[model samples]
Each structure stands twice: as structure tokens, then as C-alpha cells.
Target chain A: MTRTEATRTGLDLAPDARVGIIAGGGSLPVEIARALARQGKSPFVVMTAGEVDRISDFDDYEQVTLRLEDVGSLLPTLKKHHVTHLVTAGHITRRPRLSAMRLNLGLLAWVPSLLVGVTQGDDTVLKLFVRRIERSGIKVVGAHEIVPELVAAEGVLTKAAPRKSDWRDIDAAHAAAKAIGALDIGQAAVAVGGRAIALEGVEGTDGLLERTRQLRGHGRLAGRTRGVLVKCAKPGQELRADLPSIGPQTVEAAHAAGLAGIAVEAGRSLILEGPTVVARANALGLFVVGLPAAEPAHGK
Target chain B: MTRTEATRTGLDLAPDARVGIIAGGGSLPVEIARALARQGKSPFVVMTAGEVDRISDFDDYEQVTLRLEDVGSLLPTLKKHHVTHLVTAGHITRRPRLSAMRLNLGLLAWVPSLLVGVTQGDDTVLKLFVRRIERSGIKVVGAHEIVPELVAAEGVLTKAAPRKSDWRDIDAAHAAAKAIGALDIGQAAVAVGGRAIALEGVEGTDGLLERTRQLRGHGRLAGRTRGVLVKCAKPGQELRADLPSIGPQTVEAAHAAGLAGIAVEAGRSLILEGPTVVARANALGLFVVGLPAAEPAHGK
Candidate 1:
């Protein structure tokens, strides 16, 4: 659907329809909740334990904080609130601690699948996790369905565009990031000069930026701020959840790391607080752009 | 050549052939010099500036200290000593300051190629570098020619062989290291659990090991000392110079980083101070093995 159609005001839902949100840590979840409420749909918000930051004025909302292992309780809570749609947003660092989990009638059925996800990478785990949620009768939807503007649009979103010399590094970052993502190793990579200097491991994007800073301090990087950070959706990623995300804080991190700009895959990544991200990047003289989506490749 | 045929060595040259050694750094240069002298051929040693540690006991030896930029003078020095074969050993970090350079006739003539090399990656630059030397009519040979035992033999070299669980990490590292080397980005990579976590950049192998340790410390690694470090030649490398070299120091570094083993490509990489390296790894309970060469791929 066109973005305008996706963002049209009013509910296309049944009169009694209520949305259910499995909020992971990040501002995106809060934004999604507020957007849904602005349209007069009082969504049920279930905050993931230890993952989310503080949510303000949440007393009236039908929500509870639960650890990842306590995920089975989410269905009954949604069912209690009569939720028909489910959306999960933000990030979960890794597999939850099984010891702290409280498995219930809902989770006991998916024990085998959860075990399989533990052995696989985060992408596979989230894929299976979301699939299990879908099997519970409530339809799964992407946060972009609620906030279409969060999906990055094509082209530069900042006043500070990449310089001519930065294009090679930009393209290099794009290709390298995709190659690593194909292995499910990472979704972001930093390219300096003409080659990729760092790949994100399980430490995630912020860790990658910090590592790049360390490499630069060691004279490993060329003596300039000509590098770019490229983030994209992993090939065969569970699109309904775990999409690559960046916020204003990511802009500050990129600027601090001496990167020239940030490039995220258009239409496949979340740009949380989009205007502020662009404005902050522009103030710091860094570009924020959205490139075309990544193509699939067979895993080696 | 078969492994045995390659190791069966004696000087395969005319009786008048005098070897010239382009020694860079490390004990390998001094060791190579001593071996050649024992065989009755005192090779002319050109010590690259600021690279070699200490070449003690060299009062009677014929050697000259030359800055990397003074590379132009090497040909004339070889002519003066009647040197017939030239071999560059040890490590030359990068080009020297142009201002400190005293360019000789040959180096001045190859300024264009050197500039082109400067613009490209190490593999391209090294290829053109050896070509320039060969064009000057001096036959270039591998350091392994003088020290055939340096070439790593197949299979485990230490008392500790990789366990079945370690093989997956080894293979993962081998494939990941080669993939990065294919891009001329690095020669080594570290794999933990089943995925590659750190790839060598210009920071080299020690830096790669340190980065892996940091990732592990940050809980990015699987919960165990099961990672392996893999080193190999870049596909289509100019093998006469810059073969990947690991030494006793590498064993200590691997042990310190809490890895299970180290793997180098058989028939291609150099095992500096081989016996000592094996002994140290055995004492540290770490395995050191030479993996077979990487196979080619036609897949895109």
C-alpha cells in the first residue's frame, strides 16, 4: 500500500478491535503506543522486562512487564483485553535467561521451537518467536503499519549530503554489511577509505561504532572522518519484527565515531524520531540516507 | 611440488649465484642469514629501517641499513656485491616519509607504479612491488626457499589436537578469514561457537585476537573457550613475499585470549620458530594446526 494509504486517519478495524503491543527496549514502542491511542484505539502494552526504558503516564494502559521467558502469559493478557492485532518493536539483546522464566499453558506448547531458536542466531529465534505468536490467533503486524513515517524513505534525509570522496566508502559499507548479514553475523558495517574496517558482531551497532573509534585511535583508520556506517535488513529476516533501527542517539554515536554519515536500507528499517535524527545529523555535519533494499543470496 | 619434494632443499643455482637478503624485521632475517652462511653463501643483508629489532653478533657480516624510501638504492648495492638472487623477508609496515627518502636511479624510474601501488590495497601494491624488482633482472625467491622448515606442515603440530566441538569453529574461521582476505581487507579471522566474531584489519593478527577477547568479555561469545584463530594467504597472493607468519608470541596471545586453538593454512603460511611455537602451545594446552588450502568458488 502507498504510504499515504497506510497513514490515513481513522480505524480500518472492527469497532471492538484492540491492538496488542509487545514492546522491546527503545523509543519506537512508546511512539507506536501513542500513535495507536491518538486514533482512539487503547492498545494493550506488554513491556519486555529489563529491555525497555521508562514509559511515562502509563497508569491507564492495560500492560504488564514480563521477562522473555514469561512470553507465554502475553496471549492471555491480550485475550483478556480482547486484542485482535499484535505488533512487536524495538530490540532484544539475546536469548532470555531460562532460569528466570515463568512458562505457562501458552509457552509450554512452543518449548521445542524455543530450544531450536536458542541454537540459531537472533534472526532465526525472532522469526520462530513471532511465528509462534501468529499461531495464537492474533495477526502480527509491523510497527511501520501503525507509523508509516518510521520506515525510511529513499534518498538523503539530511542537509549534509555525502561528499564525492565518500561514495566509494558508502558503497563499500553497503556491500560489506549485506555480506556479513547474509551469514547472520551482523546488520551493520563501517567502511573507511575504500574498505570495510569493522563488522558488527553480537555486540550490536553501538558496540560497532565504539570499536571503530578504537581502531581509529590505533591509526588503523585513514587520518580522516570519511567513513560511513551502513545498516540493512538481514536477508530472509523476520520482517514483522527485528528490523534494523536507528534513533537520534545513533546519530550522536556516528558523529562521535567520526563517520561521515549513516546509510540504512529504505523501506526495510526504522528511523525512530526521524526528523530529530536528521536534524541532529545535520547539526553535526553528518548525512542520514536510505539506500535501496538488499537482495538475497544463498548461505555458504 | 609434493611436500617432500618441496622440503628437499639445497641451493639450486649456478655456482656463482650470490643471494641478497632484503631483511625487514624479526629474528627470521637473522636466522635466514646464519643458515645461508653455514651453507657457504654469505647473503648481502639490507636491513629495512625502524623494522628489525636487534641483529646482534653481526660485526663481520656485510649488511646495510636502508630506509623503505631508499628502496631505489637496493639495485646498485646488489650490483656492488655481485648479488644474483634477492629475497625479501620479515615485515615492512608501510611506506616511509617521502621527505626522508634518497631515491636512486631504479626507484626514481618506478615512481608511477609505486604511486599506483600506494593508492591500492596491500595485495595489489605488493604484486607491483615484486614485479618492479623482477624487471630489474634480479630473481626473487621465497624466504621458505632458504628456510624450508618454516612452511607449516599439514595437521596438528602440538600435543593438543582440536576436539570434535572445535572443528566447526575452525572451519568457520577458515572460510570467514578467506572471505575477508578475498576482499584484501584482512588475512585472519576469529570464530567463536559457530560464527566469525573478529576479522584482522590493518591492526593485524594481535589486534584481531584482542578484539575477540573484548567481544568475549562483553558476553558476545558463546559461553566457553571454544573459539579458533585462522590465518591464510590471500587468494592469488604474490607468495614470494608477505606470507602470513605466526610465532611463539602468537601462542601466548592465543592463550591469553582464552582460545582453544590456532589454525594456519598448510603449504602457504610460515610457522616462525616452529618447534618453540609447538612447545609453547602444548604447555599452554592450546592446539596449533595447519589447515589445508581453501578451495575456489564460481558461485556469485
Candidate 2:
């Protein structure tokens, strides 16, 4: 359906429906806003400062831009917009310097808990945030509710399947990555010749790939044979927020790093711009395997 | 026992019996040679180049110095010296620089396998080497066999016990260390406030500790809470060779890094100059736990 037709269907608002979008950094929020409009809901958007910009495209949306610590203002803003159903979307890039945050009264009370939870992993932080919001009488929905097609699925997504040996490396990488993730460190690990070469840390995936490439250049990487990059969710990871996601950029990075294959937790991950990602991976002869969260095969 | 009495005992070996001491870098080899002299066993030392200097003490004894890849020459030297049982000791300070090694005929056949195994973990590379030695009819014995008292036993070695919370960080560090070890990357990990801060790589323990201290200076580490350092053997490690070892120097490094606790795998790990190391750690209020390989527990 056309964008105009979807918006027209949502022109008449339902009496009790209340939707609030906690927009972070990305295009996901815009997509969610469009979806809400199609369902006769003009969602209220709470855009985080330094995280989100541009809200003029939303047909009937009211936007409030504030810092992460401005929960007191956020609650009142949601109340003012008659929002009862709250949803959070997009990336929240970590700002290690916390002194700059302008925490309000509500967030001030949460500072200690938030600090502890933040070190526990992204899922823990998101869950804690959700709990705080719920305690404020708001029900939270999954980000995928507005864009269900974005969720990844199980099986080989690329044209070429990983070789048996490459599968072993993938399985090893997955286990290592999960262990690393459990420590709230990073989300990706590169396994070459059944050994972990580099782990993703605060530097993010691009940096991790670059490090892998450098190691390869130095002949330190045993990637004379095929290697695998595995991304998986930590045990007890929250699915609604911060599920490990990969995009076209990730494919380009993997190809440049000479990775033979990539494996990600299926259903629990997002394949942003899936078609472009798969096309790039295929062009570079890289295999992309989507693994189910349950009964994840020891790909080897 | 007195040197003369020890020499009189059956522990003293006949001059004809070949004993290969695969000497690495350190004063341990010199000390070991003196101990062997007291027992009347003049070992045939094979010292790695850039690892040990002055095989002068072995002038009266059979000795040969070579690179790590001189397996071909090693077999002939051992055979010529009538070397039957072999003991490897001391520290090999240099990491394997794949590009620099000049492999001989015998090593060339094993180089590929060794490379693949090294990436898998230290044990694999050590085991592959051990297998080659065995095939050439040499018996590989534990380095601690020369000084049985150096093998650490399971329990708290220091007067100080880790605080309850610090123990959690120790446990996490131990697990992290083992995971890195399994990857054949490194043998040490430092964790503070339940987060891993540093991992050992191609660098030795001292370098690892120094790097960690620098990172801690970045103000991101647990404030005022000293971290725990854990060292252990890789998973499925070969017990007879390349066991994780600690010494008085390790304790000094730990103190310099402001570490609160140290954990090493019991029985499988060697404690060079154990009394001095423990005395220093205890004086510094650092808990030194000699943990059993089977019953994995946090330092607490």
C-alpha cells in the first residue's frame, strides 16, 4: 500500500489507544511512526538529544527532545500526550562520560541502579529502563511490532553455504562471542582456523573488523584458510531491545577483513537492509548463516 | 639432604644417562642445573636462542643451543647424548613470529600443523611438539618433576583471603583467563568490579600487567577497588608440558598493578620460589588462591 493510503486509514484516532515512541538514533523510529499512523494511532515521540533529529515527517506526532537523564520531564511529556503504550527503538550509542547528562529528579533516584545495570549489558540496561517505565504505569511494546519484517530468521541467507570447516569456526566463534557478550563487553568475535583472533569491545564492530584485518596483515591471523565471524545474543538477552543487528556496512567490513562466513542469532537479531547485506556478502563469496536461539547447532 | 648425600642416593643419575632440559629464558635453568648437579645428573640442555644466554655452566656437561624450529637437529643431539628422559623448564619470552622463523626440514613437515594448533591454543602447539619428540623416542616429563615442591597445591596460599565481592571478580577473571588460554592467545586476565579489564596476548605476564595498569589509569576501571589477576592452563591442556607458572616476579608485578587477589590452577601450575612469592603477597594483603582444576570456584 502507498504511504498516503496507510496514513488515511489512521486519520480517525481510537478513543483509548495511546502510543509513545522513545526514539534513539536511527531510521527505525521514523518507520515506527509511519506504522503507527497506518493503525489510526498518532504516537507521541520522546526523542533523546544527541541521539535523534528531524521529526517533521510524522503526520500527527508530538516530539520532545531531552537528555537520557530527563526522565522526570519524559513522564510528564508522555502524560501530556495521553501516552500509555511506550516503545523504545534505534541505537543508544554509549557516552562513557556520564558527567554531561542532565539528570532530572526521577532519573536522579535511578542513577545508582542505572550505573550498576549499565555495566551488566545492553539487555540489562534496557530491561531496567522498561521496568522503571512500567512502574510509571506505561506498557512497553517490542520495537519489531512496527516493523516485523526486519527480524532475522534461521537458515543460510546467502547463496553460498559455509564449508564444513568454516562451520566449525563459526560454532567456535559463536560460543566465544556469547561468553564475551555475557561479560557485557562486546557483540562480535572473529574466529580464524578455529581460534578467536579479535573480539569486539567498546570500539564497536567496524573497529573490531579493522583490528582483525591488521592482525591478518601481520600474519598473526591463521586465516590462510576460511574464517568465520559469529554474533550471538548473551544468555537471557532481552529480545525487544539491542538484539545483535548487522547491516550492509557489516557485510562490507566482513568482506574487507577476508571473513569467509558470518553467523548471527536468528529471530533474536535484526538484519537491517537485509537484501543489500546479502547481495554484498554474496558478491564477496561470504556465507551468512542465521542461527536459531534455541538448539543453536555447533555449526561444525 | 646434603649435596653429597643427595648425590649418593639413587636420585643421582649415572653420567651415561641422557637428560634433555629444554631451557627457555630465565635464571630457573641455572638453578635447575645446580640442583641436578647436587643429584649427579648432568642434563643435556637445549636452550632456545634469544631465550637463554651463557650455556657456560654446561661447558662440562652436554649442551646445545638452537631455535624453536630445530627439531631435526634436536633429535640427533639427543640421540648422540643418549638423552632418554627430557625435562622442559624456564620461560620462553618471545612470541612465535611466523614470518621470522627459519624452519628446518623436519619442522617444515610439522609447521602447518603447528600453526593451526597454535591458533587453537598453547596446549595444541605444545602437544604437537611433544608428540614429535615422543616419535623420536624421547620422553617428555613435567618441569616440576625436577623440583616437586614447586608444584602448588589446592587452597589459599597467602594469609589474606579475598573479600567476598573481590572473589566474584576473581572468578570472572579466572574464567576469562581460561577462555583466552583456550584460544592459545594468552594465559592471564585481570578483572575488577566484575568486569574484565585486560587480557594477555603475545606479551608475557609482566607486559600484560603493565598494560593493565595503564588502562586502569584511564579512569574507566573500578575506582579504588584493586582488580584480580587469574592465570590458568587452556582447556584440554597437555599436562606434561608448558604448564602455567608463577613466581616471585609475578607477585611483584601484581603488587605494582595494585591487584587485590591472584588465582592459579592448582597442581598443574608451578610456583617458582613459592615461599618468597607467598610471603610478599601476604605482606601486600593480596589473596593468593591455588585453585584445583576440577572444582572451579571464584577466589572467594
Candidate 3:
């Protein structure tokens, strides 16, 4: 749906429909909660026990902390508040340890799947976890559904536009990022001198940029600049959960890596604190562009 | 040719064919030099001004040092010594600085290509550099030509062979390595839980493994082990230069990264100091295997 349509219909839910924000660490969850509160639809916040660091952000709303092991209590708590929809946000740095889990009635059935999923990659574990939640009846919605403006807009977002050489690096990095994404590996890549110089793996975007910085005077990229960082959703990825994102911190990382700019897939990526991100990019003399949706690579 | 046939023919060059070793920084060049010397072919060594760390290794042979900027002098020096065959070994680490160059008459003609190639990737620079030498009547040969036994042998080389799960990781990492190689990026990748976990960038294999080590308790790889590191020649790569290689250092890196094993392409990859590498792998309880040459990825 178009941005306007999504914004309009997103808030048109039944007055009795309650939303539950399964907040993890990061400002994203607080932003989503604040947006919902502005619409007179204050979400019942459910923060993971060890993951969430700040408690005061949800002081104005009804919130509860639950251990990941006690995920069994999640649905019942949401059900108690008559929650009809759920929104998941932020990062879970490590997979839940199986040994620490004290399986309750709601979690017992998931024991087998959890055992298997815990041994897999993040995407697989997340897919199974979300699937379990959806099977219980409440609908899972993306944060963008609640705040359409959070979705990155197409075209350059910062005052500094990408130069011709920067555009070439962007294209190379985009292709490399997409290639790895196809394999369910990562969503980010960096290109220098019109060739891919780095690919993100499980280490994530921060690690990728730090590595690019370390390679500055090394072979292939010596004395090279005007490189670009490209981030996009993995091919056929679950949008409600892990959409690739950039924020003010990302702008700083890009600048530190000596990159000319950052480009993220428009409409498919999240630009958290969009104004702040753009302002930082502008101040640092780095371009921040949102790429138009690309055609499926395999179809090409 | 078979390994035995290659060894025989490698040493069966014309009696008047004077060999040249363009030694860089590594044990591989020293190993190749010793192998050639053993065959009664005392090679004339050409060392890059800053690359070679040990002059004593070539003390028994005729040698000269030339700056990469004065590549023009390379051909003249080789011709002065009547050098007919050339083998490049080890690493240059960084691209030559253009500002340091003082273009002589011969180098003056190569200004355009050098200007362009210097701004490109390592493969491009190496290709242009070698092509220029070939144009000057010197035949470029692989280090493997001088020491065919240096080529990795097929099957498990270490006492510890890979488990079934480790083999799965090897397959996944091999595909990833080949995919990146097709882009002329790098030749190594790591896989864990049957998924590509890390890819080698300009930071190279050591950096790749270090990154993997850092990611041990992170999202996807939390408590995960039995990962494998895969290295192979790039698709349609210039075999005479930069064939993927692994030595005792690689074994230690893989072990430190908690990888179960390493697999390198047999017949196409170098196993420097093979005995020491195998012994180290065995002591560390990590498998080191040589996979037979693979069919072109596109042909599949």
C-alpha cells in the first residue's frame, strides 16, 4: 500500500482493538510506542527481561517485563489485556539459551521446534518464533504499519548528493549486498573503486564498516575513497520483523569508514530518527539516499 | 598434467632457460627457491624493494632489488641476467604509491595503464603488471611450476578428518567462496550451521577468521561450532599468480575461530610447508582437506 493509505488505515482499527508492543533494546520500540500514544492508541508494552535496558520510556504506558524463557506468559498477558495486534522492534543480540528456559504450558509445545531453531541462524530462529506467535491468533504487524514515515523515502535524503563516482560504488555495493542477501547471509556491503571491498555476515553492519576502515591502506583499497555502503532487505525476507535499518549511529559509522555515503532500499528499509540521521549525514558531508525498489535478481 | 608429470616437466625446461623468482614476503617464495635450487636450477631472484623481509634466504642465489615504481627496470634487469621464465610469490601488501614513481623511458609508455590499474583492485593491478612483463619477452610461470608438490593433494591431509556436519559447512562455504570469487572479490568464506557466516574481504583470510572469532556469541552464531573455512582459486583466475593458499598460520586461525576444519581446492591451491601445516592441524584437532578441482560454477 502507498504511504498515505497505510497511515490512514493503520489507525482505522476498531476502538476495542488493543496493540501489544514486544519491545526489545533500541530507540525503535520507544518511537513506535510514542507514535501509537499520539494516536490515542497507547500500546501495552512487553519488554524482554534482560534485553531492555531503559524502563522509564514506558512510564506513561502499562508495561511488563518478561523473561524470554517465560515467553509462555507473553500470549496470556497480551490476551489478558485483549491485545489484538503485535509489533516487534529492536535487537536481540544473542539467541535465547535453551538450558535457561523454564518451559511453561504455552511453551511446552514449542520445545521441539525451539531445540531445532536454536541451532540455526538468526533468520531461521526468528521465523519460527514469529510463526509460533502468529499461530496463536493475534496478528503481527510491522512498525512501518504504525508509523509509515519511518520507512525510508526514495531519493537522496541528505543535503549532499552522491557524486558520479559515489553512485558507481553504490551500484556495486548494492549488487553485492543483494547477492549475499539471496543466500540469507546479510543485508549490507561496501564497495570501493567500483568493486566490492566488504560483505556483511553475522557480524552485522557495524562490524562490516569497522572492517572497511581497517582495510583503508591495505591492498586493493589503498588511497581509495568515495566508497559507498548499501543496505537492503534480504530476498523474500519477512518484513514485519527484520527490515534493514539505518540511524544516526549508522551515519557516524559510515563517516568513520571513509565512505562517501549510505544508500538503503526505499520503502523496504527503516530510517530510524530520520531527521537526525539526515542532519548528521549533512553535517558530515556524506550523502544518505534511499534507493527505489529493485526488481528480483533471479528474475533478471 | 598429473602431479608427477608436472614435477618432471617443470624441471625439464631447456638447459639454457634461465629462471627468475620475483620474491615477495612469505615462506612460499623461499620454499619455491629451495625447490628450484634442489633441481640444479639456480634462479635469479628479483625482490620488490619493500616487500621482501629476508635477504638471507636468497643469499646463495644471484639477486637484485627493484622498486615497483621502477617496474621498467625489471625487464632490463631480467634480460641482463638472461632470465627467460618468471614466477611470482608471496604478498605485496599494498599497492605502489603513484607519487613515489619516477617514470623512466620504458615506464613512460605504460603510464596510462598504470594510472588506471593502480586505482583498481589487486587482481587488476597484478594482471596489468604481469602482462607488461610478458609483453617484454619474459614468460610468467606459477610458483607451482617450480614446485609442483606445493599444490594441495586431494583428500584429508590431517589426522583428523571432517565430521558429517563439518562437510556440510564446507559445501556451503565453498559455494559462498566461489560466488564471491566470481565477482573478483576474494577467495575465502566461512560457514557455520550450514549457512555462510563470514566472507573474506580486502582484509583477507586472517581478518575474516578474526571477525568470525569476534562473532562467536553474537546473534546467529551463539554457541555454534563445527564451522568450516573454504578457500579456492577464483573462477577463471590467473593461476600463475595469487592461487589460494593455506599454511600453519591458517590452521591456527581456523582453530582460534572455533572452526572444525578447512578445505582448499586440490591441484589449484597451494599448501605451503605441507608437512608443518598437516602436523599443526592434527595437533589442534582441526581437519585440513583438499577438494578435487570443481567444475565451473556457471556450467552447473
Candidate 4:
């Protein structure tokens, strides 16, 4: 919307540009769509049926539903709507089955890559998908590009600032997050005391927080509290899509897990609704801080 | 018990050596005790009250019970029992609370380190604990030293060997396990479709497997199977305590999680009741292999 603080990808949203959203299951897509609509650019919302959560929110906008197996037809559909730029958002919980795919002539060329990418890490699959869309002449942009205000700024956003002990945890969790990200594993980690206690896997951030919550008063972690949850981008990650993010739900999860705070890489991560997230965190007595991107140590 | 083989720490168990086991809550301690008894060595079992699970199994041996807070008195207690060799086995589910600790003169000297160590990773706390015991003239040995046969051999141990595709998962999971281990985080990881999907955290291996099981049919992991679970010792880890281990329970957990097989670093990791684990794996249609200690990848 009006070149919201030059996108990380250097994307320029021209006045006559048409936007298409490849929506998945999350409120982020809805937020992105709302931001575009408010700026007088109604987006062509596309949802994979059974994978999207906020279907009602996109009802006012021109929308279409496609099955997971019909992802092969998404390019043609976007082209038909004359989409100039694209934003991929939210989680695709339903995987595309090889047997169910309707591989048309055009889709056959890329189906092999899709099949291989699906078996790899989430980022690999996302990169291949984005490349396919970009190759078709529709530039793919991150949802943060549409809502710059949602990007977390450097500092503690909530009323409760992290304590000195929480800073150690922040450092520990950040290192673990980066290590896993480098391996294309996941994007979140929780640290208590002075070391990592939980790591995000394919189960995602919510699951990682839930596991940490359950670990309280068990084993060596008994009586341990004031942990920190950190989410950050993979080192040298593609900034177009799948950047690590947090929202009001993240604050709730961290609080539920008995964590002192939540930290995200400033400017590299998205805050779905900045005010709502801060308000929720403050209400829950959890500090939400945006950490500076760590400097490369000895050029690893 | 006489030495079965040269221990990783070069520990020698003489026939006259009076053994004491600081037992925690798992079958491993029991297995070690049984191995010692089979060799006609009656071990003195020390069980932390409310923390040990296999109490009945040690009734025949000279045993003592103490509260978790009384860990400070353990050195003097070992001296009283004339224990020359010590082994720490199993999981300590209950942490020693500082407020409840009976910090006598000897413990007071190292109490600060204990307090700091407990706040760090498991290895840090364990190294501190073992060093204190070693300072008191008792030699500590790994449980694998008691029964050399318990150490996994470098080969597939079940009827269901890993397929060619599973090898990729093995490499990926091994790399992830080593990465986390290097940070003193944990010792196990699960990789599916050529990338790590789950990692062991403070919740332990069983919890990791359970989380992996719950992750099935969710997000990108839907319909994925034949994953690999890998466990290995931490890089440059103190070998006398906390050697990564597996047993029949591990086999069951892996099978239940739809994993294709289980792998542990050969010689560095233990397979409690090895024959039983292999039989269980064979029956469950799962493979159990012991990978040779990974060569340093271009000198890490």
C-alpha cells in the first residue's frame, strides 16, 4: 500500500498494479488483504479449500477456492485475473498429493520439482513454488510488503521489559533458532535459564510453545521459569515469503509457557497486528522485544 | 565386577572394587545392576527418594535412600559404604531445590557451581556432579562399561533394514542431532523426507517421539512415513555419564511414531537389553542400526 517503507525485496506497488493473494490457513492473509483493500486495491484472494481458516473475512473481496490437488492450475488462474504482483501467506496444512494432481501440459514441466521439494524442508518447497510463480511473470512479494506497520521495530514493545536473566535466554534461544534455520529445520526456539529448552520442528511455533509449557516442573526443568521464545529468519533466507512472524497468539502462547518474553529479529520478522500483539503481551505480563539481527560471528 | 572391556574413560573395574550406583528413574540402572550381580558383584544402590522407579529390583543389594535435597551428603555416604567405583544411570525426574538443599561444609565449597550448572544444559550439571564425586576419590564409569555387550554394534540389528531413501533421512537427522548436541541442547533428532522434522529438547527422547507422532497428518508432514530417529553423544562430550542410550521402549516409540528405524552412534551409545531391543524392532517391522561415530566433517 503506497510503497509502505520500501519492501525488503525492493518491490514497488504501482498505483494501477493488480494484487493476487495465495492464501493459506491463518489470519495474516486476511490482514494483508484488508491492508490492500483499505488502500483502494482490492486483491484477488485465492484460497485452497479446507486449508484456509478465515474464509468469511475474504467474502467481500473477489475470491475463488481451489482444491489442494489443483495447485497446478493456480498460475493460469492468477494470469487470467491479470495479477501483477503476488503475496503468499499463511500455512498450507493440506499437502498436494501426487496421485490427486491434475497435471496439465504446462504443469508437467514443474511437477517433478514440486514432488521433490515436498519431500524436503518447507523452505525448499516454498522457494520452488515462488520461483514457479515468478517465472510466469507475476512477481511474488511478502505479505509484510503490504503492511509495513506489522513489521516489528527494534525495542521492547510491551510495558514489561525483559529482565537481565531473560536477556541470557534471548541470546541462547536466538543462537538455537539460527542454527536450526541454517539446517532448514524450523524458525523458533525457547530457552530457559542459560540454554535452549525447546526447539521448533515441523510442528511449528504453537507446538513448540505447547511442548515447553508441558515441560514445566518436570525433570531438570522443575521450578525453572522466565524462559524466552525467539523467532528469526534463516541465515541468508529468501525474504520474499515465509519470513518468521509473531502475533497476539504468540504472546499468549509464550505467557502460557511461563516465559518472561518473546523476541523476534527486528525488521526481518512480521508482527501480524502490532498494537493488538503489544496489548495482549502487556495484559499477560509478558515482554515482547524486537532483537537486532546478530552480527556474523567470524564469518561462518 | 571385572572389566568387560576398556571403558571410554579407561576405567578399570577390579574384582575387589566395591561398586555404587546413583540410580535414577529408568530401566537402565536396573540393567547395570543386574549385569554387575550376574558377575557376582553386589552393588550398593543409592536411590534418590521419590525419583527412582525400579525400587523392588534393588532390594536384594545393599541400598540406601535419600531425598533429592540430600545430594550434598552423597560423597560422605559413598565413603561410609566404601564404594570405590560409581555409575550414574537413568533419568532424574526431580530436581534438587536450592532452598531445600542440606548444604554442609563440603557441599558449601561447590554449591555455587552446582547452582550455576543446574541452570545450564544437562551436561554442564552432570559434569559438575561427576567432578565432585571424582574429587572424593571414587572413579565414575558409564553404564556401558558394566556390560560391554549393551553397546550397540555398527550394523543393522533388525530384519527391517533402512531403505536407500532412509539413508538421506539418517544423514539429515544425524547432522541435526550433532548440531543440537554441540550446543548441549539434547542428543536425539527425527528426520523425515531428508530434513529434520523433530528434535529432542529438555522433554527427553520419549517426549520427542510422542511429539513426532502427534505431528503426523499435520501441515507438510501429512502422509509422510519411514522417517529416521538418530541419537548420538555430544561432540567432545564427557563419556562417563549421560551417554545417549536406547532400549526396547525406544524401539516401541519409534515404531509408534511411524519411523522406519532408529540409529545411534556405535560404541558411544548404549542399547539397553540389546537382544530384546532387536527382537522388539524385528517384531514391529522397524530397523535398528548403530552408525559408526561420524568422522569429523573436514575438521569441524
Q: Which candidate leads in lDDT?
A: 4
Cα lDDT tens digits, model 3, B209-239, are: 9888888878546557679999998887777
lDDT of each: 0.75, 0.69, 0.81, 0.82
Docking class of 4: medium
- The CAPRI class of candidate 1 is acceptable
Per-residue lDDT over B183-282 for candidate 4, one digit per residue giving the tens place of the 0 to 100 score: 8999999999888999988888999999888888675776567899999999978777787889889989988899999998887888886778878888
Inter-residue clash pairs, candidate 3: none
For candidate 3, the per-residue lDDT at A247 reads 84
At residue A23, what lDDT does model 4 achieve?
Answer: 89
List model 4 lDDT by residue over A1-300, tens digit each: 112353232246787799999888878899888888877789999987888988899998898898877776788889889899999888776677677777687568577667678656667777777788888899888766677767777888778998888999999999999999999999999999878989999888999998888898676776677899999999867666787788878888888989999999877888876778877887889988888876421111
| TM-score to native of every candidate shown | 0.87, 0.73, 0.92, 0.93
Best by DockQ: 4
How should the candidates be ordered by TM-score, best one leading? 4, 3, 1, 2
- Per-residue lDDT of candidate 2, residues A140-182 (tens digit): 6765545556567778988889887787788777877876777
lDDT at B272, model 2: 74
lDDT of 4 at A228: 94
Model 3: lDDT of residue A110:
72
DockQ of 2: 0.17
Residues A1-300, candidate 3, lDDT per residue (tens digit)?
113333342445688887899888778888888888877888999988777766688899899888777776788898898899998888766666666778679778677667666445556666776778788888888877777778887898878898988887888889889888887788999998888989999888888988888888685565677799999987777777787888888899989989989999887888888778877888999999889877431110
